[model samples]
Target: MRFLSLIWSNLKRKKLRTSLTILSIVVAFVLFGLLCSLKEAFTAGVNMAGADRLIVRHKISLIMDLPFTYGSRIERIPGVAAAVHWTWFNGIYQNEPKNFFGSFPVEPEPFLSMHPEYVVAEDQKQKWLQTRTGAVVGRTLAQRFEWEIGDRVPLTSPIWPRENEEAWEFDIVGIYDGAKKSTDTSGFFFRYDYFDEARARGEGQVGWYVVRVEDADRVAEVAQKIDDEFANSPYETKTEPEGAFAQGFVQQIGDIATMLVAILSAVFFTILLVAGNTMAQAVRERTEELGVLKAMGFTDGLVLVLVLAESCLIASVGGLIGLGLAWLATAGGSPAPSILPVFYFPVPDMLIGVAIVVALGVVTGIFPALQAMRLQIAVALRRHA
Candidate 1:
């Protein structure tokens, strides 16, 4: 208790410097929090993808299409549970390109059956499947466009243009909420028949196919089997686990995770230098007081411990404040870019924040503690006079 009082007194002796140091820590940690959240958002789909699902795209590039007939062959493969195909419509709602969202032509019945994670009413699904020009929208997309269950929405397509260059129209049959939190809630699905019938060419092609395997452990083997089946075909195939496919998309944006780690390392090193200098100066100024205590029978180790404790306390308090502010900021939610729709605070990250604080405390105190321990009582007393 007495040791704590001594550390507190020393810190209170220089209020402005302590406050400024704390503020610097706050700003740095806030940046750290933001960076980590952005990285997690970009990688969330990979981390949360279903274990038993696999994605099959074109061997050369995702932009290329595959034969729609391959869908049935994949479904018949051993250990394959279900399969569905979808092709990107690449449409715009208006002239503005910034208002981009996913628009895809899908096999409605098979798609809903394979992806049970998309929550839609049974009656609504039946209605969507029965109607030729009916559409099902994601919850997020419905809110953005103010679309209702019976509204007829007209969408402009860049990839699939109509014969008269007019906008395509569809009835909104339902709005689906994602069954899982990680499922993307910002796209709409329409009938493949509606798109196929209107197309002038490329009538029997799909952008990609998603397959569910009975055993997740055999995912790699099943993926190889799917690819091998089409090795000699005109449209080649490449199959991977759903998680790996999501990760490939993130890799296309460059190595953001590695860049974030480097930035954090640089920031922490700067914090260490600032904190170490502050503690060294504080101990130097207290040389005469420490000498008096030593002459009055205080042990050398106790003086060293007192100085170290002070440095640790300053770091810990500042770190806690900074971490708390970061938590609050993320919890409240911010307007994230379309690429990072699932941004949220994670529990493991908070624990890591605490660990960083303790590390900073120890690193900044070591040199000052050693300097105080090595001070000679006789020389310190002479300097005091």
Candidate 2:
């Protein structure tokens, strides 16, 4: 505490250089924060997914179709409460390539009733159930495009294109909101019956089944039973928890978790070099001042501690600022609907950031502090003279 003034004054001696070094650290940690957040977003489905919900898809892959009649059999399973099926509709709007969002054709009553976590008005529910061409959109999705109830939404899907390749138009009968953060609130869902009848081909095939289990603890048994029932069939079933199902899609891309770690390793390594250089330079320039401090009765250990403290202080301040900025950038309500999920800067990552700051400080300070400590009082003064 007593040496704080001296340390701070020394730091400010070359204000611009210190500021730039701090800024570099801030940038490095900011990247660290953002990268860790990105990794979290990628795996959020597995971490935050509901424990009771199980998904049944084709054994081969999600791209393959399952028999539509399989839903009734899955619902009849002992531990299964209900099963709802959905088909992907990769749709584009207004011939714009960038206008992309999730569109699904699902059994209205079964789908809505199975997932009560999605809140929709009774009147809107009734309206959606009644109208064949009705669509229910998520509140986030509706708000993004400024859509209102009763407005027409036209979407064109290459997978289920019309005979003339015209867009499929539907009325917005309801707007739904997720009760929990895990529930995706940016989706477009409409009746599978309407989609089946209107599509050019492949009417009896369903994409995947979302099964709600009566007991959360029996999810594994239920999944096993579901898979066993369809074994040896033309389209064998593979049942997994909701989280694993979502994770499967990400895994198909590549080992993103490993890739992120490698990237961060490189980033931190570069920061170490930059920070070390800054500290070494600071120590070199302050040789005369340090000699004066020794003459003024400062112990060798104290002088070493002072140099280390200055490096740690600079890194700590910059690292904290970087982490703060990263938190702000990734905090919910950013415009990255396509890539990022609803995510906050994770606490473990922040803790890791703090750890990095301290480690970097030590790494950058060790050599310089050692050099300062080993300087002979007479030789240092003679050199300064």
Candidate 3:
């Protein structure tokens, strides 16, 4: 503790160099914090996928439609509890791509039954069931568009355009929220009956089916059975656990986790070299002072600790500041709301960032610290500049 002042003095001797080193550390950790949050945002759906849920889709492609009757057949399969179907609406709101979000046509009762995580009022559920043209938007979507109950929201679909050639208007009868932070609150769901009847083509067709299994452990078995039932048919099916289905979307963009980790690793490695050089230079300049301290009875271990403490102090100060800024940015809101709807600095990730700070300090300081520890007082004094 008494040597802290000496360590502080050594760092202060080269203010600009030390400041630059700290600033570099700040940048590295800021990237670390934001990258962690970004990874979380991209993988939120896969992480929060329902344990007992499985998805049944066309074997060839997701865009291919399956027989709507498959829903009932899937529900009846052994180990399957229930099933609901949703077809992609491919909707644009008010002729703008910025207002784009995932909209789907679905059976209200079965959809609600399958998704216990979507919380809505009982009256809202009833209103959705009764109103044929009614639609339910997620809370995030509602807030984005400032939609309210009974608001008529018109969404235009290029693929499934209405037979009348007008915009497919729907009354927003309900707004649903997620039970957990990771739950998806960006999807807009509407009645499948209206969709089936109004569209020009693909009647009695479904884009995909979400199945709930009776036992979570039996999800794989149920998924296989569901696929086997439709084999050798005109519309072949592929069934997989819901988590894997969500993961497929992420994989399409490439492995975000691995990419982010690789980028972070490269950035840290460069920063390590930069910081290590700065420490070496600073120690080299202070040879005479370190020799004086040793002559005054400073032990080798104390010299090592002082050098390491100086390195750690730089990392700690910069790391805390960088992480604090990252947290504040995430708290304010997502920078790109349309793309990153679920952005936030997770506590566990922040803790990991903290750990990285400590590791960075130790790893960068060790060599310089050892050099200082092994320096003979007479030799160090001779080299003093």
Candidate 4:
């Protein structure tokens, strides 16, 4: 405790050099934190997907449509509890692409029933089912646009333009909240029947089917049965766990996890060199002072401890600031949904950063501490004179 100030003062001896070195460490860890958060965000969908659910999509590609009637067939399969279908609705709101969110045309009854995670008032649910052009939105989506019940929301789709290419209007009938942490309340759902009736093309087809299994452990068996049932057909089906399905979409861009690891590895390697050089230079400049302390009865081990403490203080301070900034930038509710819709700094990531800081301090201090420990008082005093 008494030597804490001494260690800090030694670190501050070359103020500009120490500051620049700490800044470099801060930059490295900031990149590390942001990259780790991004990797987690990319896979968040998979982590949050329902364990008892499976997704059935076109075997050839996700973009290809499946017959809407497939939902009925999937429901009949053993171990299958319920199935609901949805098609992608890429609607531009009020001529702005930035107002983007997930818009799906779905079967109102089965879709809402299957997703009991979405809490909707019974009266609102009934209204959404009864009104032909009615839509239901998630709580987050409603808040984003300040939409309330009975608001007329207009959307235009290049894929399914209306007569004379005008926007399609929908009456918002319900707002739903997530019953679970995994649920994403950032989307819109409308009646598939209305979309089918008014669409320019691709009628009687659905984007995909979400199947809930009777037992979570039976998901793989149910998925296999669904695929076998649709095998060799015109639209041979592919069935996968809900998590795997979400991860597959992320994998389409590239291997993000691997890329992030590689990037961080390079960053930390550079930090190690910079931090190591700073420690070595600091010990060289303080050689005489270290010898005087030794003469005053500081043991070799004590000298080692002092050098290591200085290294740790620099690493810990810079690493914490970097991590704090990263969290504020992405996790503190900045509304850039397109990029970081599900991003937040996880506790495990912070723990990992802390471990890295400690390890970096120890590694950079080793040789320098050894040098200080081996210094002879008589030789150090001679060199100083």
Candidate 5:
């Protein structure tokens, strides 16, 4: 701590150069925070997927429709506790594409039963059940549109236009939240019966079935059994664990998790070189001064500590500022609900950022500090002469 002023003063000698180096570090850490959060958003579904659940979809493609009756057969399978179906509505709000959010039609009771993570009031649940055209939305979705209980929301769908070709209106009966921080709460769900009866075509069809296994340990066994039950049938089934299903959905946009990792690796590698260069140059410029310090009886170890401390200070200051900004950016909520629903910076990742700050400080400073420490008073002075 006594040498802090000396280390700081050395940095102040070339104010602009020091500022630029710090700025580079600031950008690197900022990208670290935001990229990790983005990857989390893409993979949250898979991470929070139910341990005892399986997803049954069409064998060929997700876009292909599956028979809704498959849910009943799936529930009847051994080790299967319950099954529910959800169909994507692709509903648009206020006729605007940007106001897009995930809209699905599902069996109300069974879906709520299957996904216990969606926290909703009991009375609101009852309200949703009683009303034929009732809809429930996540708290995030409700807040985004300023929707209240009993508010009528009109949505149109190009995929399944109503027989009457009129706007499909739903009365908001409930606002649900997530049980976990990573749970998605930006979807709108309504009763499937109304949707089936009202749509022009594709009646008695479902997008997929979520089957809750009676024995979580036997989930894979039951999944295989369910798939075999429909093999060679007109509508073959492909069954997998809930996590794999969610992961498949994410992969449709490309292997984003791997891509994020590769990008971050490249970013950090570049930053490491830039920071190393800055420290190396700083030390070289101060070669004569370092010799003078040694002549004044400053120990080699003390000089090394001082130089390392300076590098760490630069890293710590810029890194902390960048991370703070990233935290604040995510604190409010998802900036784009339509694209990324779950936006949260996990604590583990934040802690990793802190660790990176310390490591960055040490790694960038070590070479320069070592060179400064090995300098001989006479040789360094003569070289500077």
Candidate 6:
């Protein structure tokens, strides 16, 4: 501790230089923290998806429609407990065009039964089931639009446009909160019957089917069986675990997780150069001082420790500042999920931020410390300024 203080005081002797070096480290680490957070956020939905659920989508392409009858066939398969079919409405609010949130046409009763994770009032569920045009909004979506039960919200569809119509209206029957933190809390789910009855065409089609398996461990076998059943059919099926299905959705936006990792690696490498250069410069400027210490009976190990301590101090200061900034950014509210719903930073990401900082401190200090320790007192003293 006492030796560290000496090294710190020496660093303070050139306050501007030390501060600049620390600032460089801080910038690099802040970027590292942000990148790591982004990687976690992009894959967050997959991490949150349950193991017991499986998704059945069009085998050729996810965008292709599947027959609604597949839902009943899937439910009858052994190890399948329940199933619900839904289609992405892809609707907009008013004509603003910028307003975006998920809108899905689902069978209210069976959908709710399959996904009990969405908590809603029992009376609200009954009301939603009874009224064909009734809709349910996620908690986040409700807060964003300031929607309440009984409110008639108008939505304009791009995919299923009404003939020269401005919008379609639906009554909000409930606001649902997710039982789990990972539940997508920003979307609208309404009765498929309402949509089907309103549309003049495309009556018996669905986007995908979500199946709840009897046992989580049997998901793979059941998925294979489901695929095999539809293999020779006109509308073949692609079966995946719920997590993989969610991940496939994320992949459409490009490999965000891989991009973040690459960015983080670059930032860490930049920090390594910045810290290493600072330490190397400090050692060069204090060559005479190190020589004098060696002559005065200070061992090479002690000199190395002193130089390494200086680097550690600089890195620690920067690391803490970066960590503090990261915490503030994440705590304020996640920007990723707001702008891109599929991404969200988790707690493990924060831990990784701290770990990266600690690792940077050690890596940036070791090489310079080694160079300083190997200096020969006699040769160093003989060298001209």
Scored by lDDT, the top model is 5
Name the runs in model 1 displaced over 4 angstroms: 1-6, 120-134, 139-152, 170-181, 199-201, 293-305, 332-336, 373-377
All candidates: TM-score? 0.87, 0.84, 0.93, 0.90, 0.95, 0.86
What lDDT score belongs to each candidate, Candidate 1 first? 0.83, 0.86, 0.89, 0.87, 0.91, 0.81
Where model 5 places Cα greater than 4 Å from the true spot, the runs are: 383-385
* Runs off by more than 4 Å, candidate 2: 1-3, 108-132, 162-166, 177-183, 215-218, 297-305, 331-336, 339-344, 370-379
Q: Which has the higher TM-score value, candidate number 3 or candidate number 4?
A: 3
**Lowest lDDT block of 10, candidate 3:** 332-341
Against the true structure, candidate 2 reaches a TM-score of 0.84
Provide the lDDT at 38 for model 3: 92
lDDT (10s digit) by residue, model 6, range 76-136: 8999998899798887886677776789999887888888778889999999989888999
lDDT of 6 at 76: 88
Every candidate's CA RMSD: 3.0, 3.3, 2.0, 2.5, 1.7, 3.1
Residues 195-274, candidate 4, lDDT per residue (tens digit)? 88887788789999999999999888889999999998999999999989998889987999899888998999999999
Instruction: Candidate 6: list runs displaced more than 4 Å.
Output: 121-127, 130-132, 148-150, 162-166, 179-181, 291-301, 334-339, 342-344, 374-385
Q: Order the candidates by lDDT, highest first.
A: 5, 3, 4, 2, 1, 6
Residue-level lDDT of model 2, residues 1-385, one tens digit each, is 9889988998998899899889989998888888777777677667756789999999988889998999999989899999999888887777686777789999888887877777899999999989999999988788778999999989888788975667899999999987765456778899988888888888888999999999999999999999999999999999999988888877987787899889888988888888899999989898888888889998999999999999999988999999999988876553676455345578888898888889989989989999998777887888878
Candidate 3 segments whose C-alpha is farther than 4 A from its true place? none
Looking at model 4, residue 243 earns an lDDT score of: 88
Candidate 5 residue pairs in backbone clash: none
Clashing pairs in 6: 41-344
Better of 1 and 3 by TM-score: 3
